[model samples]
Target: MKDQIRSLQRLLAALSSRERAALLAARPAVLQQPRPRTLHQLAARLLGTASLSRSALNLGEQQFLEAAVAAADHARGPGLPFVCGRRDLEQLLGVGRGVTADRFAEVLRSLTALTLAWPDGDRVWLHPDATVLFPTALGRSAHGRPPLPAAAPLVVAAPTPEFRPATGDGHGSGAAALHFLDKVLGAFTEPWPALKQGGLSVRDVRRLARILHCPEQESRLWLHLAVTLDLVTERHGRWICTERVPGWLRTPPADRLAYLAVALADVQILPGLPTQDPKLLNQSFATTGPSTHYNAATLRLSANYSAATLRRTVLDVLAELPAGQAADDGPALAAAVHYRAPHLFGPYDPTKPPVPPRPDPYGHWPKPNVAEVTAAVLRETELLALTDRGTLTDLGRAFRRDPGDHAALRAAAEAALPLQEKATILADHTVLVPGTPSPALAELLRDACDLEFRDVRTETHRITPGSVRAYFDQRPGTDPQQLLDALSTRSTTPLPQTVTYLVRDTAARHGHITVAKAGTVLDVRDPVLATELVHHRDLAHLMLRQAGPTVLLSPLQQGPVLEALRAAGYAPNSELKPSAARAADRSEAMYELPQLLLPPPRRRRGPGVAAPGEWLADLSVDEHEPVGELARFIYNRAPSLGANDCNVLATALGAGTTVHVEYRTPARTHASVTVRGPRLDHADRLTSAAGRTPLPLSLSGLQLVLAVPDGRGRPVRGK
Candidate 1:
């Protein structure tokens, strides 16, 4: 970088007189020439300077420019259309949602003004020459070093992330993530499906959150991750957690967290809102703190973020707090947020404001809802038990600093109930189990079967169903007497009369109407559709025949058959033979979140931070001694084919050497061009390799000229 800067400065000074005059006239105070006229003249001229000039762009813009150029150059032939939206830009920059959309637009404008970019339809496209203009990773420099990797996917954690030692009872968060997964397991396997349109409605979420004692948004985040990872699927407009859940259950708890970490890392969805009421939450913070709901949501998901910065911010706060205690989790997370993304938060002073009657020093600041950002990320950590009371949890430390530590994770995984286990049947209607039963057991018990409340945590699980119909079925091998006999075998004690009678009554009614399906038609007996079929208007249109009062025949398929009967006001329930594969992978299509989460681009690889000749370009000389040192430095740094013009110009002209020539374009805007093979006319105009001949330029327009060295040391004169 240092060498490149030096080369650029000398190049600027040694431009042809015409280019020099144009450069002086094109200084900040001068009006820039309109495009297509001064475009060519300034194109290459600006290219050299923009490389060394950081003034036109912020760090984010610089990164975007390099990424766009590299991706464009490699993926497509240069100049093909590429995407540059909030998503691509934000991830490329490590920016979270905290960075506003408007700020991104400002960066785009800067690149365009430099002619490095231009608006192409809705998205901006790079100039065709951008790859050459500022080759950060592609083109090699004339000087032997390779170009610096553009925004080498900046490593987070300033210097590096600090890891605190872990301490716990060796019991990890008791498979908190899996425990949540277990409850989800129960919901998916439950007989009465609660999902709406394949997604758990807010109500379903709230209910599940209540049952699990987990926050609504946290549950949703995990569920979203589950869906994203293909562990769960959607079918019949309802979510069917995939076979992976059972696979997940079978794995040790530590492994579950490991898998979850990968899935969580891939989540692009922001944890929506906290469980707390928004209006109430807003008031709790001072005067709503200038953060709108939209801003709050965006900050968590899309704000530019730096991992190192977040770690530093969090550690700094922890340093101030008492050991293992956090003043507030939200602020701790928020501290890291703005610390990592100051641009996203703007100039807002996050410190508490002085009470009224005093001027508001922080009034004009762009106060984002840092609290929401804090809360959202905090919940994410909570899933892995990464935070205990807002401070980083020992497990979290393991996740961040010591990924190798699997002991704690292993302990957590050991704590979840085993999948298959022996059962206990009791005289009362309830059944008992050992360990936390898997969803498979729960599904077998589900006839609106719910986990019942009990005083003892480790006691057998009691399956509580409202009626006996939940257990009895008229399936081929099932009989009330057989069910009673089975219960007796599982229990050492006699079955209760209530239990006996319940199974008997339910089984007696189960198959009263034996339904048989042959092709599309359903044959029913036991007074099937019975006399009602003969009297029904809708059934009259179908191929219906009465086979005695107890039997009716209909040609309609099962689904349409049920619908037609129901439409005619007959109350009927549709039941099909149970499928061996419930919510099988084939039964449902895997749906992805609307947006795909892309991992952050990997860090720059390979070597060569300095482009070719970049060392000479960036090398600086002491300007105070311009008389001697300046001349020597310029001469030494000058390309072997080109002579430095600071000390010698008109007297040392040669072929293939560059000169800064000033000229007036048709637009009359002052423009500068660096031309080679000096050609001058008495009219004071010059043209060279660029072939932009005969443009108007005065003798005075020739401000500086470079002399190229011919092997014979002979200087070329204008013909």
Candidate 2:
């Protein structure tokens, strides 16, 4: 006892405090009492010792116990073993089977200390004495018989262990036994039977062995054990698991087995194991060295993923994405996987896994299997169900909607296509320009093509041949055919000669015109012809301001000439025809100058005509009379006007003579003027000096009034 306590203490010391407490608390219930007797033995002893009256003997308790013992004994030999009978026990206990059935549980408890063996769902014998009980009613019954009253009948309990399976072989055992169990149990738990129902092939045992890092022999042995136990049974030539095992195991071992199975089911094997292989499976296990146990024959499984080259791949697939989409899971996964392992291929989202990575020599990160990663990411993030056929969840769809990721997906799709197809697809679907393609676009195209292409063309034609022809006329000496050929060769197609001529004719009219004070250039070459069209009217107006107006010729006729001059609002002696008209009408019949250069108009006289002096006299008496008053007023009020030119004095005094005057100038303050001319001529002299002189000194500057003519003294004009 002392040694036992010491051993327990050592065990306790090795365990964590929590584990120790659990073990200690469970010990009383788990450990059997010394010399424990079976329920039958106890019943027999009690029956002998108890002095029961005839009435008591007939009470049903003894009958119940007897019936229970019989049933238990019968089970011990049996086709189908069970601890108690439903009908027999009920009659003995004088109650329904439901009530008395629980009472028979004592029999099973009694057998616990005796190492009794029975088959689980699988036919493998599970020893009760070696098994641990889970905290459950049945588990309790298996641990000990139910306590009963003196008159109550004794019953047996069912013998079955209830416990969870461990993740690994922590309990020390030999490699041989483990290998045997692995094969037997692994085979029974294979998904082949279930998969076969779905029309999928069951992965081979050797393939599973490779995944589980075990030998082919061991794997086969495990399958045989499974068959013996009935966990797996052969149907035809194919091996399959019994449906019962799945229900028996609380959590299926097949889950782990399936994981391993899938991992190895598709792996590709080389002719010989190489020193350096890119595949993770090619590497040997830490504990198990490389061996022939997994040779070419056994290891010849298809790989789920293909080998890919790694390179510097950008991880931020979502950088430019706008939110929401159904297919965005792939991009979302890529973004997440890339973010987590920028150097690796990540930013992989479990909701949406990226497409499988491709091989690239210049790539910065290792390429991964896009499809596999995408599926894994979706599963990891719970955005998709394992049983679901790669459908994205609502959240996954939303994530896929992001624009940046969408673009990346498009790029990835293009990359997946054949080179020629990819190029065509990019050309049709992308916004990339010929010379200014985005780096991403350029790189993707290059990868798709599998060759280098210039990003931008340097020695390429910019202007189309049509555009050139549209601006220049095809002159007689020019090689129109050669020009057309050059343009056709430079551009995608040649400009039609007819179209070229139209454009050239139109362009020649206004080609010289550019941006001006008016507005943008519309057309230019034939200012007159173009101006006639309203489309170029505004431009024409501007051109006219620069080049003057065009004119047409007419025959020499007084009436027509007069009509033309009058319609133009021209003054007498100021009819200037256009040069064209002037050339046609020689003999000095007409001459033309710009309207800006036209001479001033001549003043009118009486009925027929008037002399200059006579007109001057009339103006002096009527309007010039005020000039004298104004000059007198100026000399009296302000002498500034009289300081220089005396022409004003002559005009004011009604004298038709010239005058010499002198005054102080502003700079030298000394001013002088020699006799110039009459102050008033048929045409006002002031007209020639418009804007040049300080003030007008002629009748043109005055307001004239008519006065009664006096019979004497030069015939006074009316005021």
Candidate 3:
């Protein structure tokens, strides 16, 4: 084992800085840990138990590593390294007729490049740490060989008879979803108590679910979506509606759907706070299932791709089906998606049930499998009216083509969705909307009547006494007559007598049984005394009033009111309920849309590195002559500026380009550092890596500056 470790160390030491960067880039979990200061530490990190399990690998790469581990286990104890020939690896991988030589070779190259396995002579040396990723679960074939590659499942088209062409615009689901979302947002217009961990408590979640008339699980998702879309935010340990609510409320249904579709596409994980960093958002959620919390290990493993990428991929695959047709199943669709972008998707087994995620210290909920994620994406499409009856719609196609094009999304939606200005008013207090009503009419109906049923083509609202009373209670000054006028203006036919009578009668009883607040109440044995206290001159500031012949009420606190009454020549006994502490008010910044137009989903940029062959060739260059990409960058002199020049460096930083910076050290020696993903901090120092080491380099010390080649080895043109 010690010999194997030493061999690995030597191999790592031989790797150039460029090579090391490329290899470590694939193991983000390793980079996330404390930086390794030496080759041995780097090697140890590469083979660490935690890093091995968390590293993202495609199915092919995973299979290759498993085969290597199995071969090592077969040849010797698990701790010893085993050299396996190319032929043996091919056999162990079950790479038979279906697998091509080039494809197999590419897999090996990727494994070697990633340092999961490395070439030694004509064979490959397997890292014993592979056993951590793939234990003894190497099922063998009948001939006692590893099983064949788990081929991507084929996507079969649904039977033609199963295809159901939507007859009307498929905007019903989205419209209904938007209505429910508005309700959820409206609930937050007032501050709501939150737990210390910055999440809604169980009782609060249940209450919110009840208010939204949605199931608890689904309601939580909607609540999270409100935060994700920035329509609501947390402030002072309380949830409150953002200023964006007003504009969002006024947006047309189609426009609102377009905004929501884009927002949902950008959501990489469920039940997470909204963040500006797209990568952090991508890393937070393991599965789109109902899980409210994810541990660090699962989060690290799931960071290979963003949810936006997955959403686009799923929509693109679904678009391939003939109009009106859908895929057979989610697993098949997920397989096709993986086949298209294997690098983006980690190892996913559709045939197996999802591995249950370890209970998060914060919370526990069900985790999703690959198939479930695909299904969840499809469900989101359905919710946005992007797809109808499980098939892609015109709007869906438009969104799939370009989710960022808000105008195009809204245009497609408008063309498909039907909108009505007037609704049908029937007898027996029933209001029927044959099509989606205008926003104004819909709001009036929702506020004035009780919704009984709603679907794609129609909605049923009944004007009930209780619903009217509740609406009137919520709107302090709005009377039944005002509501009636608004309803009459939006209705196609005259209001029925039953509806009119119900509204008027409900309004009449709204404040009949009044409830009023009182700080102190006094009981007087004599009715005359109670009446006199109500009109007492000394206690006039208390604004005392008579509730009954024997009862006297005051708006002030019990202490002050009682003292005033006693000083006014009467002794009053007191009984009071315990008062709760009031929260201290603090001003918070109001949440607003970043811009009128939806911000495009942020695309995470990877730090640039030279291609493999180029980096290897640079290793053989002469000492004095230019070596490595950085040296070549300086040699070519694409463009050069004074070390203190902030113009070029600023441009490069904004563009997320790598910069080759030559700076003077305090020792008066000149040195160069390749700044990857450079950013100027508030202290005016550039923060990024100088080779594999991250350090803050002062901008004033720079002697010369030039931009480096992008990851693919193409030089970035400079000004």
Which candidate number has the best lDDT? Answer: 3
Across residues 318-398, which tens digit of lDDT does each residue of candidate 3 receive? Answer: 777665566655566777766545565446786786554444576543233455556666665666678765667778888
Q: What is the lDDT of residue 663 in candidate 2?
A: 28
Which parts of model 1 have CA positions greater than 4 angstroms off?
1-4, 7-171, 191-198, 275-300, 303-333, 346-368, 401-719
Q: Which ten contiguous residues of candidate 3 have the minimum total lDDT?
A: 580-589
Residue 135 of model 1, lDDT score: 58
**After best superposition, candidate 1 residue 368: deviation in angstroms?**
4.9
Residues 285-348, candidate 2: write the lDDT tens digits.
Answer: 2111112123212222122222111111111232222232122344444443343233223233
- Model with the higher lDDT, candidate 2 or 3: 3
Residue pairs whose backbone atoms clash in candidate 3:
none
**Alpha-carbon lDDT of model 2:** 0.31
Global Cα lDDT for candidate 3: 0.61
Q: Model 1: per-residue lDDT, tens digit, 1-719?
A: 12222333344445454553444343332223211112222333343333334333444555556666655544443333233343443454444434445555666655655545544434445644444435543343435544434333422331212233434322335345666766666666643243332344455655767876767666666666666667666656555667776666555435666566555555554464433333333321110101213222222323334322333334344444445455354443455545444443334344763221211375232323445545556556665665555555545555554344566544444433243333566666666654343444444444323456421122243433243455543245476676566556554357677777766666666656655544233445646356657666767755666655655566454555555666888665545543522333234323235987799999754333443134223423323222355344444433211222434333323334544444434442345665555554555345554555455444333322334333444443333
Stronger candidate by lDDT (1 vs 2): 1
- Poorly placed runs, candidate 2 (over 4 Å): 1-333, 346-371, 376-719
